[model samples]
Target: MSVFNSSRLAGKTVLITGASAGIGAATAVLFARAGSNIVLAARRVDTLKAVAEHCTAAHKQSGVQAGGKFAVVQLDVADKKQVAGLFDQIPAELKDIDILVNNAGFVLGVEKIGDIAESDVEAMFAVNVLGLISVTQLLVRHFKAKNSGHVINLGSVAGREPYANGGIYCATKHAVKSFTGSLIRELVNTKIRVSEVQPGMVETEFSIVRFRGDKSAADKVYEGLQPLVAEDVAEEIVWVASRPPHVNIAEVFVMPVNQASAGISYREPKV
Candidate 1:
């Protein structure tokens, strides 16, 4: 038998943004294995479809009750039109989403604000901050009507403290932190739960995406020390989402054993 009774997760639906890769992808898999119907959305249709397929397989093998669902949507969260149309496209069976993971975020160019390209700054804000809020605005309506649901925003250690050359990205994450906090307060007195997960130095395609597929540049980041993997953060999200309805996990700061803070790390020399 699967770890969870199918009935426990039967009607629970989880919608994950940035589900094409990294923490988002890993979260989709974990939630599926635990029996939540999944809706995977990302700009990369090919990769997103792969993740959606994994969710279907994971749920099927994990004993999700009859009619439990899995779906994929080609979504560019930064696009107002796309975000606006997203929920409308969701299948009826998965309409009452139980969880929304605002995990679509990225960083581009490790350069000071002055040296940063205009496009990079705009991209970061569009996807990391406004994009998150846009999705939340739409979903909160559904959640509020029921007065029950969980919203998990993927923040970063940078959000807690700004780093050199990552000013714009950090600023955007800070916005996420602020937005999530305000949202929590705004939704107070309702059973709607809101949480943020701030992770430090997770070794995922994050670096690759940040550097635009420059593998060597990305590899240099963790050459000396072990960093947290996508799955590590995914486990934390699963724990947060699984908490009792009345117990809202407000925030989680996850870091690798070798990492003490956002910028502090103990790395082996020449490793």
Candidate 2:
């Protein structure tokens, strides 16, 4: 039986990076609904605040406010110092965090590998790979000391299969896949649980960022069929975190039915 039960997360504290929008925002709300106190962190303070309010409103509606907790922090995960500082602030608000969702990542520019600028590739690694490693390691150190915690790394299907023009982005995600697997093996005997959630072609600001605000280019990624929504990914995060203490879901990849693989997909417009 799957140990993904809501009651498993009751009274737990969860710190989610990139909670301002996209998959991170969705997971924050889902975790809040499941009775976990939420620490929402993102680069945009206003956006984070709005997400927190939404979670609070949902908790109020369901009569889950008894112990429901939420807070927002403006953070840029790329900064190692800031990442460590943000983790320090977690304990003061909701005590020790039982879950850490390292979902703060973005792709700057999308181009064929040969056409890509050197700086763009560097930025991709700066945020996607290095930032993720720093944040996860910081949390692992904290959790290892206490001997308990769940780390969820947000990866992409592109990690498994490289696409035509998204080489750097795919490389970063591939690193996440490898790093997540390695972390799980290294901490296999410990109480800390590390899991990776790989999502494919979600309708969000992801493509816009990749194309540098080129709406037309961004639209091309989801031209046909119903793409995965942020809420869909968020629900998976909550489920993975809700698993029984003894159960650890190492990796979960969520993609639309139309998306059979990273590069191959059934598009509506026949692009």
Candidate 3:
């Protein structure tokens, strides 16, 4: 028997930030397969459209008669004007979003505190913290009006346990953790569900971006280790979204078997 209650997700609308790649794109596809309409938002409209096509294909393959529609929106969450006017850009049919996945986040570098560039810190916080808060605020208002919705944040193990050379990234995720916790408390009396999925060492473009396109450095980070992939984390996000109404998956920490913490991992010995 399947564990997911597909009925719960059918016909639901999900808005995913950073849907152009990584966990965001995977989540969009998974939700589409479950018969959910998706709004794919990211800076890369071309990539977003490709993801949308995949979503459509997934939904069709699922043989679901209803839902699974997609909207690809060019969004730079760091842009306040874009975030403020996001709904206007979305199609009217997808405006009533049932789920908001705050997954648009990135890390620029691995520089330590003293050596970190000012621009890097600003960029990290702008997208990871402020951008997430902005999008959530907009959706929160809508959810409050309807008294129904789910907010799933993409956090990181860095949020729980900080490590060297990841100060800014860790700080941003820590803010995400605090924000999610506060949101849960604020919505305790309401039907709105707030959850956070904190992943550790997911092998995605995240490391590449952190190292500024140095593939070798990024590869070394996961060398001799089987890191969690984007699909693994996406599954967790969808599972939390598919739970029964009364069951709120407050927080989930997902890491590979070899990963014990943000900085601790068991890598295979070099031949």
Give a tens-digit lDDT track for model 2, residues 189-247: 99999898999879988888888889999888788778999988888888888877888
**Residue lDDT tens for model 3, 67-128:** 87899999999999999999999999999999999999999887888998899999999999
Q: How badly does each model clash, as a count of residue pairs? A: 0, 0, 0
Residues 1-271 of candidate 1 have per-residue lDDT tens digits of 4332345445679999999999999989888888788888999989988888888887778675643478889998999999999988888888889899999999997988689999999999999999999999999998999999999999999999988979999999999999999999999989999999999998889999889999999999998989999989998888888777788899999988888887789989872
Native-structure RMSD, model 1: 1.9
Q: Which candidate is the best by TM-score?
A: 3
The C-alpha stretches of model 2 lying farther than 4 A from their native spots are 1-4, 269-271
Q: Which ranges of candidate 1 are over 4 A from the true structure?
A: 1-10
Which residue pairs in candidate 3 collide? Answer: none
All candidates: TM-score: 0.95, 0.94, 0.99
Candidate 3's TM-score reads 0.99
Each model's Cα RMSD: 1.9, 2.3, 0.8
lDDT of each: 0.88, 0.85, 0.94
Worst 10 residues of 3 by lDDT: 1-10
* Residue 93 CA displacement from its true place in model 3, Å: 0.8
